[model samples]
Target: MSKCIQGLSLGVLCLVLVSTISGALSHEGSVALSHEGVGRKQNVTYDGRSLIIDGRRELFFSGSIHYPRSTPDMWPDLIAKAKEGGINVISTYVFWNAHEPVEGKFNFKGRYNLVKFIKLIQKQGLYVILRIGPFIEAEWNHGGFPYWLREKPGIIFRTDNQPFKYYMKRYAKMIVNMMNKNELFAPQGGPIILTQIENEYNNVQQVFKERGADYVQWAGNMALKLNTGVPWIMCKQKDAPGAVINTCNGRNCGDTFTGPNSPNKPSLWTENWTAQYRVLGDPPSQRPAEDLAFAVARWFSKHGTLVNYYMYHGGTNFGRTTSSFVTTRYYDEAPLDEYGLVREPKWGHLRDLHRALKLSRKALLWGTHSNYSLGHQLEARVYQNSEKNVCSAFLANNNTREAATIYFQNVPYYLPPRSISILPDCKTVVFNTKKVNAQHNARTFHHVKDFSKGMRWKMFKDSIPNTEDTPVQNSLLLEHYNATKDTTDFLWYTTNIDVGSNDLPLLNSIKPILQVASWGHAVHGFVNDLYVGSSHGDHVQSPFSLNKPITLKPGKNKISLLSMTTGFPNSGGYMEHKIAGVSKVLIQGLMTGTQDLINNIWGHQVGLLGEKLEVYNPRSSKKVKWVDAKGHDHEPLIWYKQ
Candidate 1:
């Protein structure tokens, strides 16, 4: 049978088993199904060996799928595909910025609906791992923090600051309370089995010095107090507090990985990075299927009971949610691509590995483990269940370029370079990482339609008023964050400069240079409503100077500067004080000296006129009608309303 059919069959069998178990335990005071078909509460605990769910040891296989990254329409298919890929647990980071973009005002509808996403996963009979990092650094805007948090006075983020802690606790408690109200926690019979507090803090702890350790301890303590009734985890944290399980996160964590403070806790790999995220100008990254499979087999051989892929399916980073350096397309070369297509050997090979590992769960999880080093870079790991007389073994060759023939249990097996061989019975080779039995599916792209042929276009100019007709400020220039209040990326700074008759003689002969120093991602200038020039800034807060020579009329000439931001400052110390927009402006080659246009009554606009008209939303009733236009190409500043 095909894999899909097999998955369907397995799903039906699992449902039957769940029903039988629930009915059998109803009279024993154990968990039973409710009238509404919700699962009853069950105890989940972990020991030095593995996690025990209801007195039975389990091997967890999870996959990461951020809810806000994909649309609501894609949730069911994505969850089903993950299930088909042998994922029993679905992990997701609750993006704070997407839910509370304006601070205190939360949105849970459409793509930002966290509850709906969790329910979909539960419906598929999969568990959940909730990574609630209000300060998640998933290459997200402001590192998943609302922009308004910077406006608070004396605010320091991710530290021992009182203001920061108060808000963090508020948001964290809000999420926990919301979940508790709906009984969405594991203790309440929901699918959420594990919850993570802070993410990857140890990687940059030294940046905050002493306060860093204090912040981490406080955050962990705060999460414990939430009483989610599930095990709390902190990924990539070496000095994690007591009661919080410290998990490993990387491309490959070997057998030596153990919980930081609690070594006896179950060894859990929270993030096995399937592939690296895509940067703007960098080439795409991928891992070999053989190496990935070897990593999984080796982990199981070393007695790892829980492992979660960083991204089983990396979807698109829609709209402006992308960070400063990340690209629009977030295809991480995972088992499933952005469009939900299975990535050939990686998907099938891992599925096969999962099946093979499941067959040896009895011996691996509840047996004795011993490791022996064969010659060179080859090592042999064995797991034996003396009670059941079952045995499993993994022979790994870490050598990158040379294969090794190793003798395991008096039998010779050829191990390829950087690969592993799995022996389910300890005497016979059941599967080899280098030998791929799955088909190599390839994808082909074809252009199906010419969309421009049937499209009609319309043109409209931005109706920007004069500087005297709008709000004015006497400062050099207002910061972009302060003026826009994080409402939109575009901010307009309009000012007027009057040239006397005496200056016209010199201005008419020699073009005056319009210089504006801005601290922003990009800036576009306009003189008398005509396009002047544009320039961009770097990632750091450096001043980008826009120097272009221009003609000035004898009367008042309006100068408009539009500043745009790729994303807000996400990290570093005192980042809340970082500012954007025009810092200084001067017109060189005037009559007497350089005229400073900084301190003036500058008109301000928050966003583009097209945004005000809801041009991007096709379903908006306020959308304007489009008329056919004959302009093949035009200059900048021309807006199309189609």
Candidate 2:
């Protein structure tokens, strides 16, 4: 009862658990192997049971490594590390926004070079799973859709709408053609064995309502037409069409998930999340290495043939590519850290589990399965090759608090609470999820510099234009993206307000305040070029108001507002419609409607004037020279350069 309640329902969990045990032990299959040489045409197919590579059943271990996440120089080392970690396949999402930031224009060089990354994987004797999601939501900008797509009139994205489908088809075809021309498809004897059409669309498909199904079907059909000669998969899309295979994407998926559509399709876990992506102001999320290893072992025990870690090496986000509110460090606490360092115990422990799984491959892939209830929350699952009397087994203890002992096949074995022990012969334990054999290494930070010697520094002030000098727009406010095209993080909103004697008397009486309402990641206010106050919004889309006191100048007074963005919203419904910058401004306590600056002709500047002068560029020919400085330490509004 306790086991059943802990699993939320004993019958369902037991039924699935029993089925997994039976599937692993009962395999009435043995297929002849076909050989192939390097650079030779190979075949990859899957029956309802398992993946057949060159006419023989095979198991695959894959890991995700986004090319754009890491520099080009890091690719070879990263791939090599993955290979050494017992990974036989490398998966990557071809980022649409990174490759084509502008419509009708594409870039495939440097870090965005998909071909180069694939080739490197192939050189390491690994297969590839190409996820070409024009709508990939890997916490990417605009969900990997180019921002220019928002400019298209009446263009509803990720749907069956004519405009969206047309553009989606064009881009998909472009990628397919490029790969085909380079002979990079599996049918062309390349490393790519599988291609993913769409990402986890089912999660947000409800927003599209009736069009969701149509869009999914369309995406599947489009991928099939590409003729890649490899299977197409749709992760997290349960109602996926017949042509595409739907796979699971989270941890412990093997415990509850089976192939969608048909049992004939092999069970595949596309993304076994090792750790979670970090957001700003949130603690780093981590998964125990022991738990991760247990998940993998249980997956294989349930007859899962292919399992891919979402991130085997979660690299750095670098630059402004991170999603809004996400921290600059893209560390997902994967097997490898952001700097390519192996995450101890997790890396070594998983390596050992992989080795143990390989030892039982023959029995697992071709034997008969049986499961027995050892009672006391302990279970024994066995896989036996009747002809050769060869057997493998998994003994599990599900109780959360107390460990249990079980006698399987008349052999007494101690089982740790909430753990699994693997026995290749069904009688001796070779590996146990609870017993860790890897070394643990703690990280420490060392101080590399002394600040006791007060160092010399130089300062430069940003040369910003006043309302009289900058270009003025008739509109009172404008969206930051539309005005700046995301070329810079800063947007200047400057306007002049006249303070007559009548307004001065009111301003002096109530201590008049300048009020501004805006949508932003952050905003700064200036009155007569004097810094007043600043405000910030949440990581997601949010509206904030700023209020600052101002001194009346009697005649004309200038107000400058600086609106800045951390990054744009990368996911959500109608995110393209989100706006930034000051929407309205007013001086309260100044005699009502007379002080409204809503319709004023505001001066607009895309970035600081110092940016134009190349003051930040160390190698610029027009770069400003630093001079010996004194006094003015810790002064605000001063820009320091090395």
Over 326-352, each residue of candidate 1 has an lDDT whose tens digit, in order, gives 666675588888887888888888877
1-642 per-residue lDDT for model 2 (tens digits): 112212112222322111112333334232211124434566888887677776777778888998998888999999888877778889998888788887778899988999999888777777889999877777776678777877788888777788888888888888888888878766576888889987888887888888988999999988889868888899989888876888899988868675567776788899998988887777988889888888888888887888999789878776667777777667558987887778888878887777677666776777677776667677766676766556778888877778776655434678777888987766567789888898987666687865435666676776546776777566568788778765677899998887776766453545678888888677888888788888887764478888887676677888888988776777666666767878889897665343778888888888877677767677762467555456766544567754
**Could you estimate the TM-score for every candidate?**
0.87, 0.89
Error of model 2, residue 361, in angstroms = 1.5
Error of 1 at 382 (Å): 1.7
Model 1 CA lDDT for position 372? 66
- Misplaced by over 4 Å in model 1 are 1-38, 255-259, 499-516, 537-549, 553-555, 573-575, 586-597, 619-627
CA displacement after TM-score superposition, residue 323 of candidate 2 (Å): 0.9
Off by over 4 Å in 2: 1-38, 256-258, 387-389, 447-454, 501-510, 589-596, 613-616, 625-639
What TM-score would candidate 1 get against the native?
0.87
